[model samples]
Target: MIPFHFTGARVLRPGGLIETPVGITEGRIVDAPCGRAVDASGFLLLPGIVDPHGDGFERHLAPRRGAMLDMGDGLAMLAVELAANGITTAMLAQFWSWEGGMRGPDFARAMLEAHAAVAPLQAVDLRVQLRVESHLLDDFDAIAACVERFGVGYVVFNDHLPHRQLSEGRKPPRLTGQALKSGRSPEAHLALMQALHQRSAEVGPAVAALVARLPGVRFGSHDDDSAERRAFWRALGAGISEFPETLEAAQAAVAAGEPVIMGAPNVVRGASHAGKVSAQALIGQGLCAALASDYHYPAPRQGALKLAETMGLEAAWALVSDGPARVLGMTDRGRIEAGLRADLLLLDPETGRVGATVAGGRLAYLGPEMASRFFG
Candidate 1:
């Protein structure tokens, strides 16, 4: 690959924004000569986004109920979307749940296999994050084996069962639709949910044993609703809090030095659709560490720009890049520094649009307006 040098750009350096040339050589940013030069004047050059957790690709994998696309094709398309949005490192959050079909263990294993096969073909650094349902006690051993076989680096605990409804002996809302998607009868699904809810006591120990068996892997907790719940997850070695549902939970995570991740849509929308804690409030209070795209593919850049209205550019950008990289224990590609990976983005400062995106020293995406600058 030919070396590329970007000059006349307002680069986001460690100190602040500076007008200087950035060089890329052999996939790393370096203070070296270049084979080709691109004029990046009047553009804001920042680090490419490192999304720590996102399930936006779920739509691509299974666009409709019982209709699924090949995982490799889904992931390839996902890479383009990530590149277009200036994301270089992405953790695709795939669920291993008791929810029957796509969210079940079989689909999880299939996703891992497809990821292993297609990840090498994509420009973005695609990593797997296994989102395991806390109530899947029976699949703990198999899940652990899958993690080992796939070398999954991140694992997060999620409990989405409607405990209130289950304990009341009533079928959860939308039981028929969920059952159809899972290829199970509504009666069977209701029975399964009831069984899982009844075994909640044993599930905790089973989860603890599962975590104990998988030592040295990064773990996270989802939808923490209280300080006590956050503490419980912390004790289980889950140092990352994903989408803390309450201000207290977010505060607890922050106080304990855990990174709290909120959805980028919350920042862009100015409120959480779930009517939980506001992401902007969390950011303002220094409680939110990162803003992931969540279910939307284009929210990170737009959300950061929206947040820049209050927190300035560098601080807002950190929520999508540096903060997430730190949370994931990846110190390689989050910032624009010499010797780090050359994952960077050039944006229209005024429009807040991505003009070009370079991942691992390769120009993975280029917008039409900037076409002449590089191609001419």
Candidate 2:
């Protein structure tokens, strides 16, 4: 890789943005320039986005029903989108649920294998985060084995089953649509949900045991809706809270010293589409630790910039960068400092669009406007 000196841009640092020339060499930020100088006079150099959880790659993997032919190629295409969105390190959230199609255990395994094979060839650093259905007790052992086999470090527990509706012997909303996606008849899907709902008593212990088995992996709870729900997961050694649906859940997680991750869409939209707690509200109360892309790759950048309207760019950007890096236990990237991995984004100050992106000191994306600065 060729080294480059980025000059004249307002580089975002731990303190704030400053008119400091940045140097990158051998995939690390350096104090002295070692290669060609690039005049980034009109750009705002900031840390590349570090997205903790996003499943937008699912679209590329299976663009149509039963259309998942080549996962490697899909992942290759996903990398371009990640780079274009200025995401350096991203956790591709894949579901290991009872759902039989793209989100099933089989599809999750294939996605992990494909990512392992194709990530090395991409400029962005891609990792997998398995979103396991908490009530899938029958598959806990298999999930553990898959995690070990793929060297997956992050896992989040999810419970999407409509327990209330099932307990009341009522049909859940969208049952038919969900059943079709899972390749099951409506009757079979309802039966499965009822069966899983009946085993709710077993899920807590089973999930705790699974966490005990994977001592080295990071565990989190998703869509926590109450303080008790957050506490239950925290007691099971799951320290991270991903997208707490209520302010109570978020506050509980934060009070427990666990990092609370909210969806970037929630921040950008100023409210949750599901009518849950507002991410902006949580941010205002100092309950949120980081922001994840959720299902949109561009959201983190847009969310942070939107937040910069009030909190200042440095603190708001941290939610998408250093905060998430810390949540995932990654110490190498997410900051524009000497001796760190050179993961960076250059944005147009006037329009706030990403002009260029560099991941691990390699040029990942260069917009047409920024081409002359690098090549001329």
Candidate 3:
């Protein structure tokens, strides 16, 4: 690969934004141009986005029920999708839940194996984050074993059980469809749900044990709804609060020095689809630490530009780039700096569109108007 000397762009650096050109050599930023020169006039060059959590790849992996595509093929396309949106690093959130089919443990294991097979050839840094349903007490040992087998690093606890309705002996909506999806009868599903709910007292010990066994992986809790719940996860060393459902929960996480992650799609759409705490409102109040792509691949860039309404572009971009990198304990590639990885995004300032993306010093994605800059 030729060293890239990017000239005439406003670059984001540690000190702030500067109009000076920058150079990339051997996958790191350098002081002088060593090879080809690319005229990047009228562009904003920012750090490549680092998405800490996202389940958007689900569609690509399994476009429809029982109609799964080849993992390698799907992942290759996902790389392009992510690079087009300026994401350099991403955590593909896969679930291990009772929901079965795509979200079940068997599929989770297959996805992990597939990730290992396809990750080396992809442009983006794709990592797996196992989202384990908290009520899966029967799968604790299996989950721990898979964590070691697959070399997975990040895991988050999620509990989507309709505890309130279940406790009142009322069936949650979609129980019948959910059971069919899981290859179970509706009555069996209800029985399983009731049994799991009845064993609520044992959930804490099971979670603590599983978490203890995975010593090196980063742990988080999803959909935190209360300060007390935040405290419970904090006690278990789950330092990341993913999509806190309430302002109080977000405040509690922030107060305890935990990173609060929310969906970038929420910021772009101006409201939460689930009617939880608004991510835009959280960012405005300085409670949100980072933004994930969540269920939409294009959201981070759009969301950051929208967030620029309150905070400046530099700070807003940080929410999708540096902030997420910090949450994942990564210090190498979020920003464009000397001796750091050359992961960058070139954006057309007027339209707020990504013109090109460079991941690990390679030209990964290019817009129609950007060919001249590299080729001319």
Candidate 4:
């Protein structure tokens, strides 16, 4: 049993939050006091940010104009960066495309092994979001095995139709921005994308069946453009709309009980880098249930601040903590309650940067000097 108190902090309790000290015993929040003894003073005690999707792309994992980093190095870099950002849980959104060719395969294989090796040594909670690109349907066999072996919690349905998204009359470009990041030559990338498109049209029922067959995994559909389009696949057990491109698709997701997952960068920046609906509108309507960091590492934490700043503190915190927790089926940890796990974060209420992080009854992140006292 571990007992500690956080005084003068905003303790976000089940019913509501109060400026008080929280008591922890056996990793459970057993009590809270009106006038605290231990001085929390100015710390913001909030739930650890639950990131549904975001990858190591920023670490040159998917280098846009520069060289790619070693997979291990990328993961290591991301671990430290995210914890500091106040993200307690992260889902590394790995994009695997058959048209992606050799690099995709190499990165996927290496990252899986790297995940296994790094957890014991790392301080943060990192999870995997396997973004299965539909164009790469041919690699279904290899992918099924990977999901079974890895604890990839989220599986996304991504079909990037190159010829369709490009200029209507022109031949598909040899390499798009995404392909360049993957280090494929334009000609090779175009060829791979085209082949994958053909393979998708072939539309092997086997691939769809395999997707449904994979257990212990939740299904997410990416870049949903319309409600009709979104529903067609949700009927097939696809429960997540990763980046709904339009209001109708987002509404469609809500009506069907599927959560809408948008990028935090989109919400904070007021627009999508890709041409998509505004995240701000989605959040205003309560249409958005979760916010993933996406390609930006600090967006999740910053997004929370932006939300609180724009909408109000109580509401903004709800989006980052309670909203995402409910969507992910993580009821216990998201809201501060008596019986929930002690996965929590301490940040400055004014600024959103995470100052300390706790997970599974252990203080995972602390200041450089006190680190010894907690981890000692």
Top TM-score prediction, candidate number: 2
How much lDDT does candidate 2 score?
A: 0.92
Query: After TM-score superposition, what is the CA distance of residue 178 in candidate 3 from its true location, in Å?
Result: 1.6
lDDT of 4: 0.72
Poorest lDDT segment (10 consecutive residues) of candidate 4: 30-39
Write candidate 1's Cα lDDT for 1-376 as tens digits.
Answer: 6898988889998777998889999899986547788899999999999998899998878887656658788888889999999999999999999886778888888889999999987778999999999988888889999999999999999998999988887768999999988889999988888888888888667777888898878998999999999998888788899999999999999998888999999988989998999999999999998999898868999999998887788899999999999988888978999999999999999888899998988888899867889998
Model 2 backbone overlap count: 0
Global lDDT of each candidate: 0.90, 0.92, 0.90, 0.72
Report clashes for each candidate as comma-separated counts. Answer: 0, 0, 0, 2
Q: Name the runs in model 4 displaced over 4 angstroms.
A: 1-3, 25-28, 32-38, 57-70, 99-103, 165-169, 174-186, 368-376
> Each model's TM-score?
0.97, 0.98, 0.97, 0.86
Q: Best lDDT goes to which candidate?
A: 2
Over the stretch 228-317, how does candidate 4's per-residue lDDT look in tens digits? 878766766678888799999999899877899888999778899887899889989878988888878788778878887677756776
- Measured over all alpha carbons after superposition, the RMSD of each candidate to the real structure, in angstroms, is 1.3, 1.0, 1.3, 3.7
Over 4 Å off in model 1, which ranges? 65-69
Q: Which ten residues in a row have the lowest lDDT in candidate 1?
A: 62-71
- Model 3 score (lDDT): 0.90
- Residues 1-376, candidate 3: write the lDDT tens digits: 6787888889988767898778988888886766877888899999999999999999889898657658777888899999999999999999999888789988898898889999988778899999999988999899999889988899999998899999998999999999998899999989988888898888888888888898989999999999999999888778899999999999999998899999999999999998998998899899998999999988999999998877888899999999999989898978788888888999998998889998888888999888876766
Q: Which regions of candidate 2 are displaced past 4 Å?
A: 66-68
Preferred candidate (TM-score higher): 3 or 4: 3
